[model samples]
Target: MRLRVEFTTEPFDLDEAPAHALAAREVIETAELDAVDVGPFGNTAEGSTDGVLEAVDTLLRKSLEAGATRISLQVSVIGDGNGEGGR
Candidate 1:
């Protein structure tokens, strides 16, 4: 299975990127994923189910440890690798 994950860590800092945000970015960038897009408002990654799950786990822990008060995340099964529909 394949998954796509979108997430954000807060409290936001308009002046610069927060520690939590930087942590999240590092997790995604180094993870075994594809289609990575990171930005101030949100971030996204797509990969195999196991890869996405593992990355999410690390992201949550690191971001919170870096002082993120809240995290908003969404995950979706995008495909089954056979060109079939997802649930």
Candidate 2:
């Protein structure tokens, strides 16, 4: 069960914010039945559904931890192993 996640946060620059986000991603990638590989950096992460959900949770937590005022997230499930990779 794979899915995609797009997340955006309130604008505020913190020196360690991106690292916090990436750390969250790393945690999600290896947590449970999860594996995450980032796509191009336009606010998208695509992978297993469980992984995606976990990653989103991580993202929200990290964003809050980083002092984000707002967090917005979108999710889209990739093709159902339909041989196209949802490209």
Candidate 3:
């Protein structure tokens, strides 16, 4: 299966990106994912089930350790890995 993940780390810093946000970006950028989009307000990535899951694990741990008081996340099965809808 293929998955897409969207996430945001809270305690926002208006002046600059917070440590937690930076950590999350690093996790997604280095993971085996595609269509990565990291921004001040949110971030998203897509990849295989295993890859996305692994990245999520790392992202949560690192972001929290970096001082995120809250995190908003969503995951969806985008495809079946064979070009079929994820029905």
| Winner by lDDT | 1
Candidate 1 lDDT, 1-87, residue by residue in tens: 899999999999999999999999999999999999999899999999999999999999999999999999999999998877486
**For model 2, the run of ten residues with the poorest summed lDDT:** 33-42
Give the better candidate number (1 or 3) by lDDT: 1
Scored against the true structure, residue 48 in model 3 reaches a CA lDDT of 95
RMSD of 2: 4.0
Segments of candidate 1 deviating more than 4 angstroms: none
Candidate 3 lDDT (Cα, 0 to 1): 0.95
lDDT of each: 0.96, 0.59, 0.95
CA lDDT of 87 in candidate 3?
44
- Each candidate: RMSD: 1.0, 4.0, 1.0
TM-score of 2: 0.60
For model 2, the superposed segments whose C-alpha errors exceed 4 Å read 14-41, 82-87
- Order of quality (lDDT): 1, 3, 2
